[model samples]
Target: MVRASACGRPFVREGAVSAFPFDAVIFDMDGVIVDTEYYYLGETAAFAKELGLNLTQEELNGQVGTSHQFFLRMLVDWFERAGKGHLTGEEALIRWDEWAHKRPRDYQALINPGAVDTIRELPRRGVRVALASSSPMDSIEEVLNACGLSDAFEYVVSGEQFKESKPEPDIYLHALDLLGLPANRCCCVEDSVPGITAGKRAGLTVIAKREERFGFSQDAADKIIDQLPELLTLS
Candidate 1:
């Protein structure tokens, strides 16, 4: 699929998303908005390395675009299967919690460039905005408060509040419901395949925020862009 430029120029490609009717935008937090993906990865990798359970790039990619709870389980399982740790699942989870508390993310350093402006600009364009994130509520709150955008969104829903996370469409669907907007009138901003899947499955137009931090991609999205403000044109 060809990506459109801010000036509305289209390059050669086969993919085409429906032109704008989006009255609302649903954003995924990690790589798309707060740029917390790398911080999470760095912290996880350091913890794994300390246990002699260094994760390869592929292993890291496997954990991206999902809730921290799921990621922790997966990491613990990997640690056991790889003969890297003797901790029980419960013990492993405790270790993760301890580490998270010890190393709270520095939200200011991680905020994605152009993210705030992009979000604030939406309302001016007559578009409503909400957040659908896989992070826990506390983490989401910290991000919103630290980024100085706690009031920018109309609604903020965490996947932790839902029965399912990304790739399940629950969070996005909930956001749409709360916004009182249909999928066709909303745009989903995502940075991973699972997030894209959730958005598309919810019948919303999905815009993939391209980043190399995860090194994962496929044909599941409706659009792709290199950064956040690149979407300002669509707004």
Candidate 2:
């Protein structure tokens, strides 16, 4: 068994490829790295309420781990249900974004416990790190920079660049391609059902950060951990 020391170098037995089992790790930003999923759900529900749409939390939860385009379509469907069918998905997204910007969240304060330490420590354990998020690149950059993680990942990919998002596995597959690692050689950290499904579909080990809220099921994940630094215990 290999173990990584908190402060010193990782320990490995003879002929071990590395202290960590995986060659690389790819992280998801929202619920896994930062505690922004709850905030986003709140914002989504509030925005719908302001529009008199009365969307339930369960309804907004459907948008979690989705691409920007998929979210827009969800907004359109929700609005149409509230008799606002005249508004297109794009128009609805614009309105929602404008509303959300009025009271912007401080992303730095939302960094999950041990997230930074875990990300920084993985490389020290002989693992390369990357990030793949359903967020647009601008949003990804903003969160990363705010959390003082601008240099954290060797590569960062956004689902906005792909034709499909999480549940479709395109983003994670693309991240694997970018890292030049096979899915079996890497793992993905995620908290949402769609993200877990994506990682599994991509043939990577999916480690879920336990998330009981938002009516999500993480049963599909290969492993579950309460905090980011728990990853250090693997292998």
Candidate 3:
């Protein structure tokens, strides 16, 4: 349970994962479970376009892994900057959610390859599984339900449940508390810099799902894997 360097030392090799050292595995939802990070940006850009605003990829990149509250505030600011009529963050969120729901993204279709199998197989291998996502509760439920994983996790937590999310470590710390396991006894699976930083700050071993499209750096994690099922090969 020693902290590895930013070099991201491998916790395991191409061997059986049943010998996995952690007591529990906490997952981040967006890019870890589903490739929604990309789609979310698309939705955001589309919504912004409807408001006569065009957001660059660089601007949308900053929104990755951030809490919904932070995203709403950013959206409000963007709207005001675009002369789209000044609106409160809450109002912007409501409008955004309304627009998003109208489009109705197919969560099942967006699920990352091997993600569902990885989540479902973990508990059978004697590893407890939980979800800690920055998405709101309703959105979390939607994804879980659509992915047919409503009962898959021992616990499911949302960033909206806390005063702050990711990079702040509050969400991860609360998740560890709820799991009743010390950080050393558990690990976090994440993809974004904020999520990895949160796990590290919470004192858990962070395994990042390597992401290249968003210009994210996975160097802060203890390990990096190309796919979710790679967890099954850990030691």
Candidate 4:
């Protein structure tokens, strides 16, 4: 058993038990830990519009759980089709980076209804907790700090650190590596299709949050929940 100093809770890794198949829980940050999906979608949509491209809500929603680089590349392709073939992916990224950096502070929201309590409870119940998100480190830090969840996780991994993001399983695979746990002993919580696909690909039990505006499918998830608190009953 290992004890977490931040929350004063213990995580145990015992031999297989019949009741619970997992010994750890991995979390996806954006839509699952915080209500920031709307902000991201709005920002991306606005950026696309400025480039003379129209992005529908559904199309924007489909891009959830993807890395910024992936979306930037897609934007560059869109611009190319619109006769802006001179603009490279790097240029689009730079512009988007500037826009993101200059975003209003109030545009981000901190809403994780039962996140704090659930995370705090997990450690004491002998389950390791980790954060795996496609968001950049700076964005992850801001959200975690804003939501008072900076100390809730044992490990934090950003998809930006990986060459490939969600749907490729690199982030989740890296997180399990950091946790020192095997895939079968961990469960992943996600709120987007890409996230769910990543978790499943990593061989972890996936719990999909169904309340988010995007990423809800029975095919990609092992189970579905409408609220964070419901995860407490998994064991």
Candidate 5:
């Protein structure tokens, strides 16, 4: 593997074609990379506690693996409709960031284990790599940079760039267009239900990271995995 400074993208040393089942592997960021699902749980809970409201696992689940704009819209709408607060999306996000800073450590520091290794290993094995995350590009860059994996993929697609987020397949489809690979030629690793549905809708084999967040149906995925290392073993 040789590192090229071409925008920090990793280039595979000229190598033989691999016998992997899929020509490309599309990954969903957030929960899969930065453990942000867990982070969101804590932060949202903190926000709820600050307002004297109980945070339910189910409520938090709906916000998992969503775009920054999606999250902002969801939170702001809820608050407005509930007559709780009149904060704008930007203001809410600022409060969240402030809440994050007040903590002992930055949330970005808590990374999902084996994420980087799996990402690096994919390109090495002759599989094109892409990130089809529902996160906004800014959040994606921030997290990946912290993980030191910003340049590890051939493509990093954000949901905001597409017409819709996960569950609509637009994001994954856009990634396919960027990768120049057909849906059958690609596989997606996703940790959320909407993400899995989106990948499946795009006609790609969707692998689920075993998690119960978001009330996701276990049957939605083509396969379920317990850890990131499991991807390396997939053909």
Candidate 6:
């Protein structure tokens, strides 16, 4: 028998979900739900350049799916490493935020192939889905609404709502709490290393989406796929 907590009562668990198959599906927003990775990467690079720092693709890749504070801290560390120790923490943060806000709002972030169809199909198959991301609430809402996925998930969790982000279990744990399911009864889908780490740490089964540019390892993920379409068949 499943015991319901006040935090988890509104979510429904359907289908033949058990320890092996997983009952609820939790997703990471940026790369998993939509292809916003490139936009974020480009923005980060441009922000670094504006600070008179040349940030390589490799450096930017390491910060994907992380919170803004983490990204800023990493940038500060990188600046020091690049012999730009004169740049203060406040200066770096101001420049990064300025660049982020200046990105054109009309830019179409990459939408993954078959994302809409897959999300739409999940409910018919009796699977419960939710979104767990490190992005701000406003950004998540904009992307989901823009991509027509706003109504697909029963819950949308923002990493900004938590003190800890990916690589920590807080976000995933929070999602599971919202879903009213045990860790073993949930499946987490993620496209980045930190997202995967968060899911695994929360004790949920993890599916890793292979991103060619980021080069994620398969060791931590329970299942690996090259695209989001594969998830439709997993449950």
Give me the candidate number with maximum lDDT.
Answer: 3
| Cα lDDT, all candidates | 0.76, 0.83, 0.84, 0.76, 0.75, 0.75
Question: Which scores greater on TM-score, model 3 or model 5?
Answer: 3
Best by TM-score: 3
Residue runs of model 2 more than 4 Å from their true location after superposition = 1-18, 82-85
Summarize candidate 3's per-residue lDDT along 161-193 as a digit string, tens digits: 778888889888887777778999999999998
lDDT of 5 by residue, 211-231 (tens): 865676758889999888888
The list of candidate 1 runs beyond 4 A from truth reads 1-20, 78-91
Q: Put down candidate 1 lDDT per residue, 1-235, tens digits, no spaces.
A: 0001112122222232334367778888888897777777787788778767767988877777877558757767867866867766578877778767987678978888899998877767666677888887777878888998887777778887766788898888887767777888889999888888889889999998887656777467888898888887674
What's the lDDT of the predicted structure labeled candidate 4? 0.76
TM-score of 1: 0.83
If both were scored by TM-score, which would come out higher, candidate 3 or candidate 6?
3
* Window of ten residues with lowest summed lDDT in model 1: 1-10
lDDT of 3: 0.84
Identify the runs in model 6 with alpha carbons over 4 angstroms from their true place.
1-20, 75-97, 105-109
> What lDDT tens digits, residue by residue, belong to model 6 across residues 66-102?
7755865776876776676756667876755666676
Give the runs in model 4 whose Cα sits over 4 Å from its true position. 1-21, 78-85, 105-108
